[model samples]
Target: MKRWLPLSIIAATLAVAGCSKAPNGDTNTSTSSQVAKTTANEAYLALADDYFNHDLALNPISATYVGINDYNDQFGDQLTDKWLKQRHQLNKGFLAKAKKIDRSQLSQQLQLSYDMFVYNRNLDLVEETFPARMIPFNQFYSPLFSMAQLGSGGSFQPFETVEDYQNWLARLEGFISFLNRAEDRMREGIRSKVVLPRTLVERMIPQINAQLVQDPTESLFYAPIGQLPESFSDADKQRLTDAYQSFISEKLTPALLDLSVFLKDEYLPASRGSDGMWGLPNGKLWYQYLANRNTTTEMDVDDIHELGLSEVARILAEMDQVRQTVGFKGDMAAFFDYLSSDPQFFFDTPQQLIDGYMGLKDDINQVLPDYFDVMPKADYEVRAVEAFREKSAAGASYQSPAVDGSRPGIFYINTYNLRAQPKWGMTTLSLHEAAPGHHFQISIKQELTDIPQFQKFGGYTAFEEGWALYAEYLGVEMGLFEDPYQYFGKLSDEMLRAMRLVVDTGLHAKGWTREQAIQYMMDNSAMAETDITAEVERYMAIPGQALSYKVGQLKILELRAKAEQALGDKFDIKEFHSQVLLTGSLPMAVLEDKINYWIASKS
Candidate 1:
């Protein structure tokens, strides 16, 4: 799921809107003094706090991710029509009250919050138009994998205290209950003619079945019992272990098996054969909305489609040049074959791969301070993506640290097929997933104390993913992409993002089949076919998401180019980095404003 997959994690943070209504309700009347501005800003922040606190109760998953433990035991049912109604009402309420605040009276920072809140709510209102909840459980982000990730020891679910153990017992009951409701909604989806792709349903079946074990002790839910805090008395340990065993064997297994049966016998036949959301009712508009929401820009599918074609051509040329410079015989395809089959380019074992990334970790930390003034206090570790979900996982992903720093941020490298994890790609991948990439951006966002709580945890994919892609390019400045193959790896990675613009839009908007998308990817890059298939299916499972990487990366590059051109020799690379990052993750438009403001002030 990496099990912290990109689409789900980004979606988790997306709901956290930046702005809110001010305290004591809102006043639209203009006031012309710094004192009035200060008063309003204070009021706005208070509302932001209230809005954040309110959401924690409404969405406990959001709370757990944000490190707010108040609702740790309550796994709220977010699948029901009732839940969406509550969320809709909440958004409308905030939208109404927030609009009454006079923007001219708010500080620039508060104005950013106000604008983002307003933008996000409008988008949420747009989302209400789509029937996404009808088919909520996908292989990429269903309740099944989400629960597996939580119970699987290394993630958000704390195992520190006896209460932590007990909290999960209660939590899984709600999670299991949701399983039936999820199936119920899928049935409703069938009635509404809203069904997931047949390919995606096939994937979901195994993920659900993965948790169905006859022995309770072997269950992931029972894992915490094995790691029970040492401080627990002998009696307490025995009792907790008994509780978990009974819960898993009796309550949990039946629920998992029930959902799996529904998916296999009832749901799979109803699933459609089409790849894109465009095939659904109102699907064309849904894809359009998803593109805007994910990219946080006004780009349509055609604009993104053409941009992908241009970038793919440019990257292919770069790859060709690398093939020649490396003195490899034959064409780019032959070189892709050579690079892929060469035993010298892969690890014999998983430990070697882990050791390789760990080595990069030390070297990167030594060089990072030279490029940027800001750094994350939270440390990160490299681990293989856990085995249960590794089959469908991305090559690498980063999970932000627990806000309290008990668990370090993780850079999960998928070591399932060491052959697929190419040696040359490691450096660029490391930078993107770890230091100066996701770890740097996400951990820094988590560490920022000056932003509103929603903005602190909130993110837009374009800003978050764009900064990471930009980080991948930073390897050139750090002197890491010196080897021609390593540089090719960078181009390959960039090409993948660029190809996303092509294949992703091509799949959903242009009617490219799965075979067609896979063929296009293979023709263009040296990526493993296994990796290519996983990636192609990922785009199928979650549409318009892959578009975010290229769209985001290009924007960041554009802004940086502008900053350098405007600031001229006055440009400080470190300052430019800090200015973009210091505001945390903003919508692309808001990010532009922040960077342009920096450029103007410096000029």
Candidate 2:
């Protein structure tokens, strides 16, 4: 979603109600009542475009990620107390203005957009009550990691021109400023008695030090200098090199060093010992809002926790059948051990492992047409995760290609510990992270030239992650996983999501300790210890994000089953998938309503 902004994560993870002065060139809506005058659905859409464009300019990192280059040299304001206040005012004003439009007059498509915009605004207002900004930079997600990706010359930030190099020099200034402000914000968190878990702080300190390079030439920021275009004149190249050296040493390095010292010497000493959100003020209610936002459901914690427990048990019974099929003579725990340590199940080299995923591409392509007609035009490539981020990053994630096709969509396979990436998980991992999962769903959204920008680029976490998880199960329909070991891999991946339901809720809502959550995961699945540890810490660092994957997947599966039942022979898999992908990511309720309408029409 960087095509949108890394800062957009702030907007995504916490839907804070915000208000700001509209950027220059926004449609001049002189009064709050003006929305009523733009009643033609297209006019209303034009206004939505204006509002979204204003956001793109505000979040320049997002602009770079999404391929909008106007703010390529800028960085969002660090999460200052002032920034937070303005963001609140901005959201409140927009929500109020949008409310002036007559929803009854709009076409069905515009109506859906209108309802989602309003729902998101209201959700943001609710999120304004939390202290998320306090713990801004986690091991999993932080400005540090995002900036490293950009400066390392391998990510969204372009370095094809001298100005591109200069643009980044300017952007680094903003990032350096943010690091200082980060310490200030965390200090405030300390004073307010809101602090991150000790486990997360332990992880974050190393992340900060890893970026604090003393020598200019040795910096990851120096990476682009090495790759400067051959077209650059000798004089220009020398000048740019000197400038980058100065910027990294004089400006960036000191800031990183200061951040390193502050986090270790000051912040870490004051961090929370508790592992769950239950340790914070109004923690229960805080976790509740997160749960609702992630799942887009009002289900009680007990219900989600119970659902997780039930799913885990059901998946285990299936795992036993796989064990028997593979001719293992032991119970589930022994099978888990055999799968984890067995040489046959582990790849000897990273290239061999990557080759395995690449090989799946041909097999996947053949079966793809039978299950669905819609596919993204964009080509996707599989690559190992960049060394800088491989450790903390999820096993695999799909970054959408630049809509303009300057870049190919990348499937980043984390090869940190080859064993953690079990051979059994490869097929399902490739499906979920590469084909017909994130790449298919996300690329389809960006390719939607006809939809409103907010609809095109915006997302509901449950809907998006849920769609990817649902895609993993789609493997079976495609006749993948004929090998019981591979089918068990699919089940193992499915079990991980089910376990997320239990541990995410258990840790955040049910007072489960970090160790308790880890133990529960170990008992339930054959996931590697490193993977399990990182995941538990991730849930701790970000409370309810893990809940979204399973919650969204189950809903899609249920809805698909409903469509098949109602339409009988008329149900077409291709059309059903096309509807899901073409509509873009949506809230669970909105998606369900849309699907139900299709079901009725088919009947």
Q: Judged by TM-score, which candidate is best?
A: 1
Question: What lDDT would each prediction earn against the true structure?
Answer: 0.85, 0.84
lDDT of 1 by residue, 1-603 (tens): 001112432332233221232354342222224346655766677766677777777889789888877777888978777888888988888888788788887766668878888888889888998888888768776676677788877899887888988888888888877777777888999998899889988998888788889889888777788788889999999999899999888898998899889889988899888888778898888898899899999998999999999999999998988888978889888999988889999999999999999999999899998998989999999989988888988999999999999999999999998878999999999999999999999999889776678888988998888988999989998999989999998998999999999998998888889999999999998899999999999999889889899899889999989999998999999998998887788899998888887888888
Q: Distance from true position, residue 365, model 1, in Å?
A: 1.5
lDDT over C-alpha atoms for residue 78 of model 1 = 82
Worst 10 residues of 1 by lDDT: 1-10
Expressed as tens digits, the lDDT of each residue in 1-603 for candidate 2 is: 213212332342233213322345233433222333223454557667776776776677888888777887888784877777777876788888788778775655567778888888899889988887777778888787788788877678999999999899889888877777777778989998789988898898787788777788988888999999999999999999999899888888888888888888998899988899898888889999999998998988779989999999999999999999989998999999999999999999999988999899878988888877888888899999988788888888888888687787999888999989989898998899888899889988998765678887889889988988888899987888899989999999999999998998899888899999999999989999999999999999888888899999999999999999899899998999988887688899988888887887777
Error of 1 at 466 (Å): 0.5
Residue 48 of candidate 2: its Cα lDDT?
Answer: 75
What's the TM-score of each model vs. the native?
0.94, 0.93
Best by lDDT: 1
Question: Which stretches of model 1 miss by more than 4 angstroms?
Answer: 1-32
